[model samples]
Target chain A: MDSSASPLSHPFDNAIRLTGSNGHYQGQTTAPYANMVGPFGGVLAGVMLKAVLQHPQCQGEPVALTVNFLAPVADGDFTVDAKAVRTNRSTQHWYVELSQQGQVALTATAVFATRRETWSAPQTPYPGAPRSESVPAMPKVPGLPGFFANYDLRLVRGGIAPMPQAEARLPHCSDTLLWARDNPPRPLDFPALAALSDIFFPRLFVRRQGPALIGTVSMNIIFHADANTLARQGEQYLLGEARAHRFYNGYFDQSAELWSSDGELLVTTNQVVYYKE
Target chain B: MDSSASPLSHPFDNAIRLTGSNGHYQGQTTAPYANMVGPFGGVLAGVMLKAVLQHPQCQGEPVALTVNFLAPVADGDFTVDAKAVRTNRSTQHWYVELSQQGQVALTATAVFATRRETWSAPQTPYPGAPRSESVPAMPKVPGLPGFFANYDLRLVRGGIAPMPQAEARLPHCSDTLLWARDNPPRPLDFPALAALSDIFFPRLFVRRQGPALIGTVSMNIIFHADANTLARQGEQYLLGEARAHRFYNGYFDQSAELWSSDGELLVTTNQVVYYKE
Candidate 1:
């Protein structure tokens, strides 16, 4: 009578259920890992930051968690919430939700990390520019429909077209070339590789038509530990790249680099893009 | 004092200074001219949606805007503010801010397009795949360190490297044989050709340090107004690509593309990254 070991397998060992604990409101974990489609955007962002650190109660623990998928939760059973209006004592504030049939796909508001962790290093190095040496490669070009086709491309320099204009000025934010990799290999597990590097988007080649943009409302991340040092660069591939990208009025910004193709270096991300092509 | 009569001066007339009224936020601006980061991110997003359509007195007229830059103002001078928290009737909610010496570089929140512009055709088509056919040229690679040479890259296929125990499976995002024009061309405008196509950032490359990773916070864009119909398909090299790059547990996402040179299609973007390498 295991009832086929139901409850969607494990649902986070089924626990953290407190209805209206104190502050951050709405809570319902129940799936450690199952149904997939529905409650997994970082497990509905760890049940909205563990129901906003057990609500209003404040404290500086959960460093960060930001989400904004908006919709796409169809696997089965779910309900993860958060609502801490605001707090201080070091700092704490929450406003997250992740419902299911009842709608509300994704919405977030988290700003934790009142400090502490003391990693050190921001003596200021990322000011701007440096990473393009003749640049030109990027061309394997495949994945269309449901993407993720074992990747592994390279093209060290501008490949096709009458394309040939910018050959001098390289400051305002320029120079770029890449050589990616990720075919089959998995298990690097940094929150499932940061949920697949948050879906990769160097501003999808600029688009705009009479103006109408939407799809990402917020995002923020900052972590360190040398980001794994690319496991000593020898995994065949993992190296990612990008240095600068800035779009004004319509809003958009970028800065990237994540390597490991015998080069090591494994994590660094920054993004702030909002429609304007 | 015309500064040589202008080699492209006006970093914002000399850093805005308006006041009080703002006179209904003016009009007939040719959509802030070609737009893509010029009229100073749309004059601080039209003074934050004209202070939320003149404060809820509820009327409606904006269609889109969603910005966030954290820092990097200094085009010449600074200071721009906007406000209008929320609105009803049709929909309104604005908030714009950009500062320089004062601090807070950038931050925005907009939701315009209250419908009315009617113009259809995008039921979603332009989705093709399998185009390796020839793959050869891609060796320009010489950008990075101040504007990255203004873009003109090349990287055709992932140049093998699976040594360490045959490591292979890297392709979750990266394929850019880019070709962003207007290096010295001149006179295209539209926020300097959208700050030169939103400043290339195909995930970025070369930083190495073991597990390599850098920064990018949040970004989301979806523009496609025939963006000049692929610039008349005169085919000037464009082909930018991406898909499947969702680094969970930590934060990151991907989906990008911009093609030309016979391939047509001209703009696209999608991002979410939170570094750690």
Candidate 2:
């Protein structure tokens, strides 16, 4: 597939497609990205960000985004209102919302800023893993959610598959390392990265070695890469490392970092999820 | 030193006090919590949370808060408008803003939830450190910002004090571990925890062994404790571990975890800060 093909040709582009102007946009949930209960949170996040990015007055690239999932988004037409709440000389702040039938389903706040050269270093060491080419992609399992097929995931460790019964008695570790990219090979962009930030399965599944009813209450992503860096990572697999810090009182928090194939840290994301026992 | 003293007597309470009803509030910046050029970001964060906490419609304890610092808050009276955007059976979402002179200075989104008993565990190991009683509190230094005096901080390791010149050639590490609590022994609460989450100095100062022009652009905190747990904590110190993950271009990110004296995880926070060379 040619990278320069029309945006409608890519499933991701079509899923996040928004139309309207001056902060109001109309979008629809696509079946290709549906989750167990609603659309994938990452796609919803991408839709919210797309509303901002498509706005006429938006400045710079996205540096941070906080999305709060308020209610289950029913499949169909939805609207987004992305407002640039404040625009500073260096950074801009945005308030965005996704709604259906005049009811809010999600609310988000984002920070966008232009970058300049400064003292740069990575304090968090990269979790070294085998090259993407060396690892086989996760096989497409039947009966999985439709969204699973949209990503080419190469699990390196701590996958969601259940451990042996003997090993289940041992301490559980909800950590996962994988190399992932959009299927059909779309170039990397801010929206694509936003969606990829949420590609990991819920930590509960990995810890318990099984699935449960879970929903993310709130998710935050801080982008460490600028437009130039993201463009440099076009169509490349991103190494993702994720783990849970604490799962207490019906909630667990997932912290993950995404890096380019060349070991450049691109983004760090965290989300709090609620689960039923 | 009395935890039950009138709220007006405690500087932290006074710093975050809001006067108003419904979703609107009026607050002032107290001198005790002043930062280099304005109020400390933590106190501003507390003020934002307090607005929602004081609202009559608030349903439950805060689970997550994301504060975006758009402009420098001036030292004066400010108004906060907190709206409960959505309220589900288990969670309530809030959109809050702090404004001065009719201009938005800070905006935040928060999630509050009534948690129930469920399967719970901690995946992230606690970083062991010396007991709070063993380490002397950080002494009050002249010329430091007034907010520094509000927290009794005992440094354990990775202190901000510069390394010896002979050791300066070694690789820089910006990690900090400290025991912290409100000075004068205020009891633990959501507002106090929010303030402590921003207590660490910027990573640039720790890495370069000197101060620079820095400002936090956005901060997110996910609370892992319930109201009962916080009440049990009383005035005990919280062990805080903070470090920078990636410092690139003109921004850097800080990730920190706060734990109770009993080794229970309490809160995890992340923020992206802007720095000028």
Candidate 3:
């Protein structure tokens, strides 16, 4: 079957569906993408971008997006207001806010530009990994967050299983390498890529080998590939590598790179999360 | 001499100086920190943060800052309007805009939070580097930008000097390791660190072995240290290590980590630049 031509509607599409026009739209949380305390942040990010994409004044494709999670988003309808603050010759700037119950829940800024042919190369080499078919798919645990079921994740290294008592006592390195794609095999798109950028579990959970109170404060994703490049990826798995640089005081920041199966870098993202120990 | 206690004011302070209140202020570009086109982006970022830091309603220290360079900031006076869009219990969200002649020149969003004691560790090992005292300072060339004269830079590797024609034909790696601090030895502060985070030259210059028409479209800086930690680094050189992840089409993105002389990770920054080849 051609995954790109699948007739069934993808859950991702339904979760980010919006109604209304003229820079203001209404959306609601869907169960399939619910997180522990709110809708998955990646989904919210997608919604924010969608707001601008749907705007009549928006120009060019997304080059950079910064999302700030101001407060917990309740499980219900939310409104997104997207304004094109400035539109230049080649690039356009935007400010988007998601509000629930008349309260600001999240805010984001995005840059979109028209691309032209130019000198291009990748400096970061793709990490070696076995073919996706050879790796076992991550099993669906009964109690995991609903959003985990939406993606087919195959771990290459640094899985989040609890560490042995002795290993947990020592300072541990935090890194994750995995092969991932939307489950049920949906075709790759910008919104899906935006959502996938946030798929990595919090570094606190990955390093401590246990649960803790954590929330993402801000996330920035830079898209390197245009529409044509992403379409070429189809439903193929992308290799994702993520690692934390430091965990200090009550905050930690992590960086991740997503690469196409054919070795093209698709996106680079950095995010800071707040944690309580 | 006690550098921290130097009676003379620093150029950074004068560059970011503002007058006014109630989430609105006026500022101007100073000659000392001028770049090729407009003022140095780092100094503008510092000014944006200062607008918020000086706001009476601001709650905590800055944890994340995202600056979007929309258009060239012409020399002269500009207005900065910073609004605390939302102030939560532990974190505050800010929206700042810099405009000249009634046109928006730049827009930035920042998150500030009240930090508390928590488990802390550094996962990414610091790169080896010679002591700041052991390396000779970078000499000021006649044609360099004015901003270059304000910082004492000691290159450990990956200087931007042109390569031989034969070597330039092949693809080259882009990375820079250097030690840098204010030239006049001013004490460290949040705004100063914000300005320092953008000290790395465009990766295009380092990789292509020559100059290109390039400008930073967006930059994000995440602070890992607080005021107390910055105070401890007064007038001290920071080891800056930066590298490009990928250069695609007309745009490229790079990531950088700024570490203190004692090997503590002080800041992590990422940016996307537009290039005309």
Tens digits of per-residue lDDT, candidate 1, A111-186, equal 4434333222221123222233333433344322122233333433222222222223232323333454443443
Per-residue lDDT of model 1, residues B201-249, tens digit only: 4243311112224333333333332224434643244555543233433
lDDT of 3 by residue, A47-117 (tens): 99999998999888999999999999988788999999899999999999999988899999999999998
* Rank order (by DockQ, best first): 2, 3, 1
Where does candidate 3 chain B have its weakest 10-residue lDDT segment?
B162-171
Across B204-272, the per-residue lDDT of candidate 3 in tens digits comes to: 888877788999999999999999888889889999988888888899997999998899999999999
* Candidate closer to the true structure by TM-score (higher is better), 1 or 2: 2
Our model 1 lands, by Cα RMSD against the true structure, at: 23.0
Q: lDDT tens digits, residues A197-271, model 2?
A: 999989898888878989999999999999889889999999999999999888899999999989999999999
Chain B TM-scores of the candidates: 0.27, 0.94, 0.93
Chain A TM-score, each candidate: 0.28, 0.94, 0.93
lDDT, ranked from best to worst: 2, 3, 1
- The TM-scores, one per candidate, come to 0.27, 0.95, 0.95
DockQ of candidate model 3: 0.82
- Residue B241 lDDT (model 3): 89
TM-score of 3: 0.95
Q: How far off is residue A99 in model 2, in Å?
A: 0.4
Query: Residue B21 of candidate 1: its Cα lDDT?
Result: 42
- Candidate 1 vs candidate 3: the lDDT winner is 3
Which is better, 2 or 3, measured by lDDT? 2
